[model samples]
Target chain A: MSEERIWTAALVVIGDEILSGRTQDRNVAQIALWLNLQGIRLAEVRVVADRTEAIVEAVNALRARNDYLFTTGGIGPTHDDITVDAIAEALGVPVIVHPHARAVLTEYYATRGGLTEARLRMARVPDGAALIENKLSGAPGIRHGNIFIMAGVPHIAAMMLDALSGTLEGGKPLASRTMGCWVAESEVADMLGAAERAFEGVQIGSYPFFRDGRTGANFVIRSTDQTLIDACFAQLAAQLAAAGHDVVDGGI
Target chain B: MSEERIWTAALVVIGDEILSGRTQDRNVAQIALWLNLQGIRLAEVRVVADRTEAIVEAVNALRARNDYLFTTGGIGPTHDDITVDAIAEALGVPVIVHPHARAVLTEYYATRGGLTEARLRMARVPDGAALIENKLSGAPGIRHGNIFIMAGVPHIAAMMLDALSGTLEGGKPLASRTMGCWVAESEVADMLGAAERAFEGVQIGSYPFFRDGRTGANFVIRSTDQTLIDACFAQLAAQLAAAGHDVVDGGI
Candidate 1:
């Protein structure tokens, strides 16, 4: 095996509703978790307002920088939904009614006798874009270049992205381990320093928290090597116990 | 009045823990909400990893792009906590101990038997940087150029940012209105369409949902103009009832 599978992605969360705190963005965390599980690292995530210039700038930047670019929001049947137009403009393409998307929306509403020009806004797509089939609602999302534009709603976005995940390239799993000990960070600073020096391949982190009115710290060690991770955890645990502290191993 | 009073900021969340879903970043949303109340717009947000290069890159890009850049993560009494060094590298400055920071940390720990080399990691600062006083903990955050580097923990970051908010500049608040009704989005397309055309300054959005298996949609109108928002909401209400649907003046 070549071990040549390092896929990186960037997520651009659009909409002023998120910035204003009227609506919270759940897609970034959700997609990031899913992608991490699939061995793909989410390199960067940008949450911009629904402004067209901002969207166009962000879309171009992320698309140019990462292997895959995922965007959420501004794809609904309302005036503020301008992501499609902004993306099309960024790619220097024409905004048009995608036939299949139009067909899906039209058929969906036609059966219910509610298809209107307002509802048709959901069918608009940039020219030369493919539709990402939305299993939640018949209305599909647009895909132009490396950009995968999806809905803002968590349930719908997850379903649509799930229907499309198999097609995405993934990366090697980024592994980690964390050990929490009932010792102040200062008491274990030398141990953490020595561990960092010895295990150059691993990343060691200390997070101190004041929980239950008592201060404690979690020493997290991250590395791609399973052996290094295990060895380092053992060394760290022994050191903590030697320092007269209670320690617990968290294997990930 | 000069519109120059409008201040904008960008948040750069630096941690692989967040991307891996090992930690949920409540800092960004919390900051956004707080900033919004102060009439400051958090224009953009980026979540990067613990890598020095990534942190440096994000620091430079965000600082150059926004009025202020607030970063959380990679600053602690641990080896992998390299944000200070990375930020110094980004600003092309040497990471050295600032006299004031050292004094603050030393005084902070004076009651608890004082400082050590391990705790000294929290005292290092880039040349020409000011210290962001940490009220919750002894360790202080650094402010250089346009970037304010703070801790990753939600509570600490919130407290530090709140303490610093009075000194920061703010912007005109982006206003909003919520109009909920018992009509499916498809039925009110024409109303939504008319609202969009009538209020070019405002952003009209339709969020459809299902409550107890009954369908409903909330049409939210957002703008800087209060008159336009009220007018648009009035029109939207009348149109919904005219289309044979019950209307509610506010949100759920």
Candidate 2:
């Protein structure tokens, strides 16, 4: 609820494989992380199957509720991939092959000899929607209205995100400072309480993790201001040292 | 969509930790996996913050959409745990401490001699809701209007899920058969296509995994019919073996 920072987004992960628990979807977590750093809160995330009705419902709901809606999956060259038609249906638009998108797909397939009908399936998009650049595969993801449709594959999604980075209008960049020590989360309960009371704008989270057979907790202080973040981290370090816990600087 | 399937469930994960990308929620995946096997399709999965408004919105939406709703998180003895009150708001009911829930909490605290005013916060429940037994700790989860509210902790949620397992009205029990081989996903694409054609009521998914630095793929055939699933797996194995890929015995 900060001024000049009213951006909110939603993620719609479309795939029957994910709902069936056969495939673990990774794009939601990655996209949520990326958006949060830009102070763009991801308000909702829905994972639905490849069914047309389910996809249309999710797309329309998210597009109406969020400032930006991003969808991953169902953009591949398979018969089950029906995101284009579903998205078009949601927007009440016609599904047609965009010339630019077709060009990109043709160029991509031309390298291997020629484009087949199956390969051209990736070129279809909702009419009037602009193409999102895909540096990895060249067959671009399409963006219409508030919805940004990207590939289901993680590597391809990452590449699409990078290509479309500059087009996105970001909010105030959120910052965080991490301080870890050889202490449990419960041990730092009092100091955490104090830190929470001291910082109203920041969200302080304690993560107790066991890694390499060692138990430790990371007290992460997140805020928009770098100075405020640094000040909180210093106080957290001092509190940990006072509590007889080994304090160490945890990198971002 | 099958006939004679009377009930469905949805999961609403209430916590800022998940949205902040600080904690990876395991409950959604666990619930989906268990529910799928029991033939109860998880229609939607939502992750919201500890905020009462967000929780209420999601709880109401999911409750209206699915036959049953399950909520995890915000039941602990902390200020951020506000799921009880939020559920009441969603149902337009007043939240009060139930007699049985209070008795369990009082007895639990009496044993440890650590009962504080803040610790009793877990006893708050919406009116007309029944308590779901929590075997891990005496503090019980609440169920109201087909919404099952449980702890966010993975083990506690699992235990609560088990206790509520008997109460679930199921559909056709979903079965899966996995065939693991050395063939890459692309190499077995044709076999998968054929398997899908051969199995009408089943959903075949391809999972490419890497274990011990060896790349492999797992083709999982899922269906309500056990006979069709077995037959499909047999056909899949035979096709893989015929194509020079070693087929292993992998039953459901």
B-chain TM-score for every candidate:
0.89, 0.90
* Residues A1-252 of candidate 2: C-alpha lDDT, one tens digit per residue: 556565889888887666666566678777878787666877778888778998898888878978999999877654566899999999999999888888887887675546666667778999889988887656789899788998887877888877776567767766777887775454456577678789777767665555565556667777877788888888878877877876778731
**Tens-digit per-residue lDDT, B2-90, candidate 2:** 55564678888887777766667788778888787666887777778678898888888889979889998878654456799889998
Model 1 lDDT tens row, B99-215:
887898799888765787878889998888888878877788888878889999888887788778778766666677898887677666666877788878777877777677666
Candidate 2 regions with alpha-carbon error over 4 angstroms: A1-3, A107-114, A135-139, A178-198, A205-220, A230-252, B1-3, B106-113, B135-138, B179-199, B206-219, B233-252
Worst 10 residues of 2 chain A by lDDT: A206-215
Regions more than 4 Å wrong, model 1: B1-5, B111-113, B196-201, B225-228
Cand. 1 Cα-lDDT: 0.81
Worst 10 residues of 1 chain B by lDDT: B1-10
- Computed on C-alpha atoms, the DockQ of candidate 2 is 0.28
- Candidate 1, clashing residue pairs? B6-B171
The count of backbone overlaps in candidate 1 is 1
